[model samples]
Target: MRYWLLGALMVTAGASANTSLFNLLNTGDRVNPVAMMERVETDHPGYIADFELDVQDGELRYEFDVINADENTLTELTFRATDGTLILQRNSKLEADDHDELEAVKLLDRKQLRFSELVRMASEQHEGKLMGAQLEHDLGISYLEFKMVDENGKRKHAFDIQKLKPLPMLQWER
Candidate 1:
């Protein structure tokens, strides 16, 4: 019975040894997603709209979408999972929308309240680590929405891009 149990455990460990990057983080591996996100965001200096861990061409990679403060540029960065080295960088020009995202960005820039500023505020106000952030337009108004996690739990916060005031906490469904 002891040998059988040992053999089963070894098989389980072997099965999980080749798990993907997403599973490694989910299973409480050494790498922290928040820290990785912060590193990429700090190095890139833009609004981190989205991120994902996936295997491309048989290699694991972390993909991030960052939009510049002026809302005129969008950059996609991909990093290698093993060493966190940047493998790919692609920049594209964003078209001006009818709602004029650039105009809102310009107004925020005048007040020195860019996307990076909002990320700083979110980290401070929440008194926790930021997981991710995105700039969104609602009803012709721009808002900075962010998610954070600490001892309490995960929470979402939003700030009015124009006024730089914190909005009401969003009621999140588990």
Candidate 2:
């Protein structure tokens, strides 16, 4: 009976070890730019931007820089490494105000925390005021933006923390 239980435990552990979120969510090894570009062009038509693919944090990621004909930043997009799914997309103009606020917040003296940690703290501290939160990265700066709605939903405050530095990107072998 003891041997059977031990065997069952080992089998279960092994099975679970192979079924991580990364494995379940990621279908492919990494995305190739040529392939991704082809797909992007076909899907988005004129909106697609020039992109580069590289390994970051042991995962494959695609970094795209889209500039309009007027030489203004339009959007910056990043795709996941394991799969080509879009992880982040930002419109430069739309984020301008948020970016400025984040920069100001970065100068504050609060203890640094991870994105998840900050969100947890904000949710706990603000409770009913907290709506949603997301980590925003722009021009190599990382910040957290929290959206809070008042009880009447008449007032909204988008709080930002600009000082929390982003984790360094992992170096990949060429």
lDDT of 2 by residue, 66-163 (tens): 43323334567778845679888876652454443343333332343333345444444442333234444455554444543332231222334453
Write model 1 residue lDDT over 68-158, tens digit each, in one string: 7554687888887666888899998765552344445555556765455566765576654455565667777777667654444556777
- Model 1, runs deviating above 4 Å: 1-63, 68-71, 80-84, 95-104, 151-153, 169-174
Assess candidate 2 and give its TM-score to the true structure: 0.32
C-alpha root-mean-square deviation, each candidate: 9.0, 16.6
Error of 2 at 7 (Å): 54
Residues forming the 10-long window of minimal summed lDDT in candidate 1: 21-30
Give, for candidate 2, the lowest lDDT window spanning 10 residues.
Answer: 165-174
- What TM-score would each prediction reach against the true structure? 0.54, 0.32
